[model samples]
Target: MFISFEGIDGSGKSTQLSLLRDVLEAKGHSVITIREPGATLLSESIREILLSNKQTITSTAELLLFSSARTQLVEMIIEPALRDGKYILCDRYVDSTTAYQGYGRQLNMEHVELCNKIATRGVMPHVTFFIDVAYEQAQQRMQFTPGSAEPDRMERSGREFFERVREGYLAIAKSDPQRFVVIDGHRNREEIHADIVAYL
Candidate 1:
């Protein structure tokens, strides 16, 4: 089974993903975790470029860069793992492009979807979990404390952009009830984890 997790910048996706991986591994399932634009060496380089603010990128160009990363990840990691009957847990997949590019950047969603199909070669997740949180709440959680990592381009997109991102995720969740399960991110940590477990 392939499981994908999606959320805003500070929606506890990393934490929840960590817990989910541990739980699944404890159950003795063969599992591997892959974050898009990462997991592979070349893709990690691509990730740095994608997350930076070094250039003013067009929507089409942004979509293509992300798709290129997905293409590399799918070919080098995802396909091989799944072929060996390994359960793959991915953080941030093509839905991210749909939200960030398609809605937030006002790009053409159908074209983005087409690009994604080529990226993944038509491998869809068995289940996808979208952590639902308010844009304001996410911003508060994203505060850069002392010793904290610097904000990426997506993180610095401002509240209005995040609002559009929230809407994009909800729209995706609403469009596909069977594939996407949205969990309110305002809940306690344990509560959120439990909800994900229930959904799984």
Candidate 2:
């Protein structure tokens, strides 16, 4: 089974993903966990470029860069793992492109969808768990104290951008109810994990 988790920066999707992976592994399943824009040399380089706050990248360029990274990841890692009968848990996937670029950046949806299709080569997760957290709450979680690590480029896209991205996620979930599972992210970690496991 291939599963992908989606959410804003501080929505706890990563934590939930780790928890789920642990449970699946304990049950003797062969599982592989990976994060998008990473997991391969080429993709890792692209990830650095994409996330660097110092680098000024255009919206179109950002979209293609993300697609480039995703293409490399899908061809080199995801496809092979699925063929090997392993459960793949991905931190983020193509839906992120749709939300971040198409909605957050206010890019053309048609182009964004086309890019996503090309990047993934039509491969999609069996199920996608979207941890839905309110934009305000998510921002609060992303807040950093003095001397702490600063936010990444994407995280600094501002309130309006993230709000649009959140709306985009909701729209995607509404359009694809069969594969998208929207979960409330305000609850405790254990409760969220139980809900995810039950869905699986």
Which predicted model would earn the best TM-score?
2
Model 2 error, position 194 (Å): 0.7
For 1-200, candidate 2 gives per-residue lDDT tens digits of: 88999998889888999999999999999999999889999999999999998879999999999999999999999999999999999999999999999999999999999999999999999999999999888777667433537889998898899899999999999999999999999998899999999999
Off by over 4 Å in 2: 144-148
TM-score of each: 0.94, 0.97
Local lDDT at 43 for model 2 = 94
Given candidate 1, what's the lDDT at residue 51?
84
lDDT (CA) per prediction: 0.85, 0.93
The residue-by-residue lDDT of candidate 1 on 1-200, one tens digit each, is 89898988887777788899999999999889988768888888878888898977676877888888899898888888888999899999988888888878878778978998898888888898898888777767767344657888778888878788889999999899899888888987799999999877
RMSD of each: 1.4, 1.5
Candidate 1 contains a number of clashing pairs equal to 0
In model 2, the worst 10-residue window by lDDT is: 140-149
